[model samples]
Target: GGIITQTPKFLIGQEGQKLTLKCQQNFNHDTMYWYRQDSGKGLRLIYYSITENDLQKGDLSEGYDASREKKSSFSLTVTSAQKNEMAVFLCASSMAKQDTQYFGPGTRLLVL
Candidate 1:
């Protein structure tokens, strides 16, 4: 019930190309989410799933994001395209709503 702001959102990949960011957690948490962070700002939620197949969109959920086929993993896809695919993709899981969240390492993409 609060406003989320993203200062200059990032694009992930070229137009019409699949860019997938995968996440896996071992704690078997019930809730998982994807977020992006900027050096000067705070974490911004992109998308999240409460359980296996339940998805909810965040402010930046313009692309495809999902809970994985297995409960231990989750995926955030800037799917079949974006003008530019760059953002710090952080995956976090919690045992219950707003409980302590354990975060996976942020993902960085490189293209030459």
Candidate 2:
């Protein structure tokens, strides 16, 4: 069994601020992902990394940046925060892109 950890469980930011979220896993998986969830909507892919130092942009990647510093850690940055909004960011990992993914506890963000 493995576990995923997301840091700073809660994030509060101001409009236009650049905020960062982080994830780490012990599964030794090769594929890691970052997803954003808006109220009443399904999860949206924001970024993914197939291996260390390799990053792939997803549908919502236009306003974000990601990094895979090592096989077990991945991070994401929101280029510009929107005011009076909230969202949940989830981190997941799988053995391969098409394999079952295990998710981490999400990081909740609130922009004030």
Candidate 3:
């Protein structure tokens, strides 16, 4: 299968700079999502896409950018990396309310 979820284990974000994280899934799922988790807190939805080229903002979507141009790919970008924004970014895919989502290993963002 061409299904693989990968990103740099750790991304160093320069202050006030834009940081991008990439994710790819080949599960043929129709929905892809992005979430942010702080040190000891719960995961908060950042963004989600129901189909190719369709983007929906989630509760914590401010200060972030996301794209879903292809069925198997999606990208998330932090508009402005800040010192207080260090967190884990998680990506997942599912069949839009029909199946459980499969989450990819999280990518840590270390804003310096």
Clash totals for all candidate models: 5, 0, 0
Clashing pairs in 3: none
Per-candidate TM equals 0.75, 0.97, 0.92
For model 3 the TM-score comes to: 0.92
Cα error, residue 86 of model 1, in Å, equals: 3.0
User: Candidate 1: which stretches are off by over 4 Å?
Assistant: 1-16, 80-85, 110-112
Of the candidates shown, which would achieve the greatest TM-score relative to the real structure?
A: 2
Summarize candidate 1's per-residue lDDT along 1-112 as a digit string, tens digits: 1111221233335567767777777787888888877666689898888888788898877766565566666777766554544457678888889798877767764322
Task: Report the alpha-carbon TM-score of model 1 versus the true structure.
Answer: 0.75
Q: Which candidate leads in lDDT?
A: 2
Stretches > 4 Å off in candidate 2: none
Q: What is candidate 3's CA lDDT for residue 45?
A: 96
Which pairs clash in the backbone of model 2? none
